[model samples]
Target: MGRKLALLIATYAYEDEGLRQLTAPGHDAVALAEVLRDPDIAGFEVTILVNEPLHRVGAVLGEFFHDCRHDDLTLLYFTGHGLKDDEGRLHLATADTRRTNLAFTSLSAEQIDRAMSGCMSRQQVLILDCCYSGAFPAGWLAKGDADVHTLERFQGRGRTVLTASDATQYSFEGDHVSGSAARSVFTRHLVHGLREGTADLDDDGNITLDELYVYVHDKVVDEMPQQRPKRQDNVEGRIVIARNVNWAPPVHLGEEPTARASAPEQMPLLQVTPLSVPTPVPLVAGRMRWVFRTGGCVRSVPAVVDGVVYVGSDDGALYAIDATTGEERWRRMLNAEGVVRSTPIVNGAVVFTTADRSLYAVDARTGALRWERLLGSQTTLTVGIVGSLVYVGASNGVYAYNAEDGQERWRNVGQGMTSYQWMVLTERLVIVGNTGSHVYGLPQADSGKTWATRIPHRSVSGPSALSDDMSLLYVGNSRGELRCVGTSDGERLGEHGVTGKAIYSAPTYVSGSTESPGTIYVGNDDGHLYALEDFSYERKWRFVTGAPVRTSPAVDDATVYFGSDDGIVYGVDVTTGLERWRFSSGGPVRSSPTVMHGLVYVGSDDKGLYALQATY
Candidate 1:
């Protein structure tokens, strides 16, 4: 029933020569204050102190906690340099703090503990984003279990504490270069979750303290593997921290929004349109809807279902983002050993492969892991899901698992597969491209019964698409040979040669309805996207790009969209192969485009997931 209060302290301009000047504390404080003070969000009465002297900070810190009542919710956040004294006691450095005389010049953990102990608030939360901030409770009591004893330091009945790192680690500063905005890696995610409402893990319009800690913890570790954020809780009940501004009422895909929902932005962004290429009707790229930033490069192809877009990143986590706002909903850590380069497949569950040579199945709604299976060391390709079965190709062989339980159905060994082999799933067969200029079609009923077809070229590096009748399969090899093989048998029907050095982009086949001849769209390492006639393998037109077009093109009614290694996503006319519009990202884009509704979604190596919409 009482008001919410917050005291945010940041000290970066240290006077002592031994103390290192930090660039993120001031920026972190300002961002946190804005989110906490917003009436629609946290609605906290905030008192922020930036670069204050030790004496002034101590006085304000004491008075801030002293004014709280038993029913009030009090939050204390500090971002600065946390130092240790000769006795291994923790001290918070301030603007005028000296390293030589820490006991008198800096604020000690004991002093803050004393002020917190005297405060009447039972709902108290302490967040420390600093080097060695985890030593606060241990340094104060020097007693029992670290977590339990830390909770006892504060005299309040229910209190929670979150630190940027454990006692032995240092908090990291991120993107603090000459021209970029300075930000602490830990606090940056904190503000992002609160402001974007991503910390609302349940999507119930409320963000709790525990949810905030978990969101920040995963994001921090993904960016800085050396730093592990810590959280110790002794709260009796959930403490609601903020209201989710981005929360939208649950509306299933294809269903109209309820009266409570206002517009497209208030609804979950879900893709209903299928992805095709080289259709009769062409579409053009309009304006950029939004771009979502992650901690690392985003090379994983995104899967859109309902209103959430699921994608993996080099940051070692799978993120589910809202399609409309480009704000994250939830992120789950898959593996620490390797980055996620495989595109995610979302069925009833989400399936993806990490660089660690493992396949993971997680719940679609909450991102909770359902099951995981270890594969061959080279198993890192995107998985294919058909019905209740999931298929993948590894260096050793092809493997199949039950999509629901992750149970191994079969493994056909001795066939050589590569990381780039794009497994093409059909009604009766799982067609896979290999590294040795060979393609295999393993029968769905029996993976052991496989048919191999040899291409008179180098390795097959991309995916294969079926003809409109599903009787012919077309695959491209590293030697720039487009080979068409009969689906029933592995006999090569025909081949078309190109001038490109290689072709890593998967070929997409569009039927063009019953009126037009089928067209095939593919990209080449020679920096061009080619549109070819399906049966005759005749080149209709070729569109040139600045760099290699490594991404497969996604086609809708009027346009074919794809990304180039030059860091640009281009929309081209499907019929003429003429350029329509282009959007540039910060880094190279290897992720394929996904088109649905009136929007196009793709990822870039620049750590961005972009959503571009067509102007009506």
Candidate 2:
């Protein structure tokens, strides 16, 4: 491993009256330097310069990069005023920087780039937490009046740059005074992620450059939505930046204190079964109840139990919030690399899959790690829990594990099978649709393949929905076709074709008599949510949206709720297909809505978990 090195420069007090003094840079530099110098964490030989003049700062920057070996990992951080010349070139302002004489008094990006270009070290990182920090043009060539392109300024082999904001926004400092409020929003999150060991996104004990940037970006945006962090990367492979000082192997029951590395499967499996909880009263009308924000996009569908909402996010953590007040109860970071994108399955324990191909079972009440199991290289396709068994679908196969200890009981691999939706779990079988134009049903008692039904001219777009009596399965495919099959042997029952381009949304069936079969609601890429008669297979009503409705709808007593890519959540009457209420979120709404305790809980790409009023 190469030695780690860091150069931190913070300029706050300016000589020119035109440039206002900033209170956060000096504090930010000192705090970051301390964390970087820790031998157990970053282990970098850090040199910090506060309020330094242009000549001294420039000389040290050159020496810092030029003196490092090709194998060494070097990090450069700047927190101050990033001013642009009349020609739109970015310049880092120093203590003696003059507004009128910026080119001569301030450090130019060309000077820093030249030093970096001359360095032999291939592993280099630059972090800028300043205003207009992204205004550096490509190759130091001026793009007269063009938008700021920070990547263009530092795009090279083995180079990475992280900026606090894009060219159009200003970096934010919470307050102008020298106190706790003076912390720079961007730098504060960066330090917190590293120091607290949360930046180790994969939960693998090592913090990579990509993980750190994502963790920092999510936190910065969550705190300051107006500021969007940007990054430029040209590295060949993984670049480990630091070790997570606070990380430790998960401790399980029956494992001795010294046996921290024991495999999860080695522990005895317990019968941790889900409770038989009654459903809450459904809402008659909808209103905005409360909105809770997370560190990153909340694309994972939320699971509500016992007046609490459990959700996951790209920020790499599972969050539990109060259903009524929307206050955070607890959070557990799973894996930063693959983040919690799959919907969480909450029983006695909360089961979730990360993009990193790992499945974790945690305590539902307290968010404590119960057990973890590593899956195949392919990302987890879907996760489901029933009684003492947990079912997982991946690109490689379908697996069954003990819900309590994550012990694999059996696995059935099928060639070319891939799923992008949820797994439909029945009392006797686990049904799943695949993009390979096939559907598979596995016995719940074991991994025996029950049936394999194939579709023609289209692939299964999402998960299949079973009828209330569990006799029939309704599936939607990429060809805008809705196919019905018998759950017993996967026999084709009936089929209906829609004019929509593709059906990515899972089919949702409302309960009715066996003969009636209620209404089946599904969304497609054509921006319409189609309602069809279950037995007749005839279209009843269709509601249109501003964008594609890619998520499955959650039907309550009288209303159906779903989200759209247009950043809106809509509640339409179940029978009339007339809009009841709509809530606009900050970004796209991909997470499906869950109605519980008279509130509809949903996650948005804007990093918010919203609790909309549905009661009165």
Candidate 3:
């Protein structure tokens, strides 16, 4: 049997003073429209209401109530301004709404409840994205001691209600590019979680309503400690709103044949056998460890190989440290004034590129400079080692140098304005993006560029993983937009904008299956660390800090680590998005964190390098 579903999206941008003046027209309405059209929920029949004429909320509600009755599953969504009257009744404001005649222009909770009273199906879901919606109130429960006595008569019903904030709280407004103003804090996380598929923690094809609620509840509280989302649920039975409908049922045929009716005969006595005892196996614990730190700010990532840790710092030096101890073995100073923002790439006995604008190859064991070359005047460099060749990006172009001699092999300069921060090398081609909003695919064998395609926006950070199949290239932009561009011709596959202030950090990929897919972690200027799944682009979880997060995230196993501008380093649960622990620092952290052995290495603007014991 086919399932029936109804979705209603309503937004009130007209009532918001800031929203009314924004140049971006239909931003909130368009966001809701996009969700409605998402392929994941194609089975749903969606109805949208936005800034309707005043004195017409009743007519709109009447139309929705009538349509919802025919659906086997119903979902009603609202996004707008809500308030409470002197009587404590919750009311949704309309476009031409006035405080004096709110009853005529706005719809109250009581009116909605009465309208939905006649719904036939047991499954009904209501999502209220408005201020003071928590005050809408559920059915009255007996007070105090009387509640215990009345519990026996209660029967579970399939009804769930989720509101944006508590009765006394107010919603916040972010930038217009973010899509909405006066949006409920809880709603932001809820929509993000749903879109990103973070609620599917087990990697199940279906996402349950309970999972969605739990993720949103925790993230909202973490981001806004004062405002709490209210949830009321009596729906115990799981309903499949959508699924892979193409599945075929197994076929079988049965006939009413003669029954064999003869076994009232003999019963055998029970026998007991003595069981042999099994030997217990002893468990062994792992013991090897390593630690390394740069004397100044260790703003660069560390590369571990051959029992040594290699890292760079703002002190303009690269250090090789013992893999098992926190002691440094040797240090080589690079002749540069700028900090090292690139990780050291190791090939054989040579360690390379520990400075921002120069490429240096040093002996892996002795820390002696083998060869040094100035790559460019301004380069957002990150090193990629492919076989014996090394790939690097600069403001001018992408360069390939022989790792054996530090000699230039070939350079691909698409344009003078292209500022490439990162590049990934494939067997046949090299993929890189620049601040000019262009991504180029260059052939490794030829000096000329293979293809160049413009990205949706300017990319300021490094490019993340290129799909194993080399089908898509994922990159994050300064505006918090994450996009997957085709590796073939740079055609846009899909894009999802992060719902934070701004994204200054690069994205990291988790290694896993496509179904249980890897995660993309990035920090935002809004002081939050977000984990988004790669397959569905659904948000897994988020951790909030007191300030912006300008550092990239580091992931090892099931834990995620990142530093924030609030001068704190956090370890979070990868699946549940819960904070396991946090370590305080002296100043703002702009450097990306590196996790190796059992320690987390990071640097702060306070001129100190920190090492914290990794606690699972």
lDDT for each residue of candidate 3 in 1-616, tens digit (9 for 90 to 100): 3234444434434432322222121234344434434544334545454444443456656665565544356676766666565455566666545555557757766677766666665677777665432222245332222111111111236667776565444454443324534344566566566666565444444456777777788988788776566677687676543322222223346744333322222221112221111111011111113324455766666676776767777788877776556578888876567466677788765445544578878889787778777886466657777777777777678778888888998877755475576777767778877777777888876677777777666766665656657676777776788878778777888877886355777777776674578778878776678888886788887776657787878887767888876566677778877666555454567777777767776766655555667664
Candidate 3 wrong stretches, greater than 4 Å: 1-295, 336-338, 354-356, 414-416, 468-470
Each model's lDDT? 0.76, 0.77, 0.61
Candidate 2 global lDDT: 0.77
Candidate 1 whole-model C-alpha lDDT, 0 to 1: 0.76
**Better lDDT candidate (1, 2):** 2
How far out, in Å, is residue 101 in model 1? 42
RMSD of 3: 20.8
Give per-residue CA lDDT, model 1, range 520-560, as digits (tens): 99888877899998778789999866578888889988989
TM-score of 3: 0.52
- Residue 483 lDDT in candidate 1: 81
TM-score result, candidate 2: 0.53
**1 versus 3: better lDDT goes to:** 1
